[model samples]
Target: MNMDTKSLLIDTSTILFQQKGYKSVGLNEILKACNVTKGALYHHFPNGKEELLITCLHSLNEVIITDIEAIFSRHLSTKEATISMIDTLIHQFEKDGTITGYTFSSIVSEMATMSEPVRNACGALYENIQNIYCKKLQADGFSNESATSIALFMTASIEGAMMLCLTQKSADPLKTIASLLPNLLNSLQ
Candidate 1:
């Protein structure tokens, strides 16, 4: 299997998976999109569709983790950095006039029960996000319990809000959610 062929398969699948939910996308569609034959596909991914999908998930997860690390690197306190990251997302969603519908949520929800490897990969992504949030909050001076709760709330809240925004095709939800976080923090104090 040519290395370019494998990368091409993963790249094509990523776009399709992101635009359309994983379940909605078919392997033939990906192969056609990549202009690759069955032999090449199987050569690059012997485990077949599941293996390929897992690779795609891993690629996406790595990009997000790297982005999160960059976000985490630039602040004296966790609150500032966390808020900034949230704000960035909010701004992006607002620019589009809706939460762009995160692919992670869609992928995890689609494959969670059916595929062990897919579920595990998604779980790792969630854990990484949680760890980043929890660590930041803890460092920012919140008690572990409070930090954990806040982090979890923010995670769920943001994703939920994004889904709503995407469904509604409006960014109001995201912007409002971002604006409200400060109030939430205040209430916690």
Candidate 2:
């Protein structure tokens, strides 16, 4: 496979999988979307769709961590950083009509029971994202337990808000989360 071919496959597959859950997206759809052929796909991903998705999950994890780190770096506190992150997501949802990046929740809800590799990949993705928040909160002087708790809470809250935003075809859920975030973070402090 060529240098761009593998990257193209992973990028295309991530979008399709993010839009449609793991079980809903097929290899043919990914191949067609990427304009990549079966031979090239298999050449790049010998284990096929599952391997490709696992790769996508890992790639997405890196992207999300980098984005969160950037957001955290820009603010003086985790509270401000997190609200900004969610606010950014709200804008993305409004502009793109969906969350542009980030996966795991949809795939995990759909494939966690069926595929071990997919489940593990999704688990790692969430863990890495949560760690970024946890570390940021710790740096801002929250105790480890409080930071861990808030990190998990924020992850769950944001993901649920995203799903609700998708389901309602509105950004209100995320907006509400952003509005409530300051209070939520302050309560723990």
- Which candidate number maximizes TM-score? 2
Clashing pairs in 1: 97-171
Tens digits of per-residue lDDT for model 2, 15-54: 8888788789988898888888899999999999889988
RMSD list, candidates in order? 2.7, 2.0
- Candidate 2: which pairs clash? none
Give per-residue CA lDDT, model 1, range 101-149, as digits (tens): 2337755456546678888887787777778888887887788999888
Instruction: Tell me how many clashing residue pairs each candidate has.
Output: 1, 0
Poorest 10 consecutive residues of model 2 by lDDT?
Answer: 100-109
Over all chains combined, what TM-score does candidate 1 have? Answer: 0.87
- What local distance difference test score does each model get? 0.77, 0.84
**What TM-score quantifies how close candidate 2 is to the native fold?**
0.92
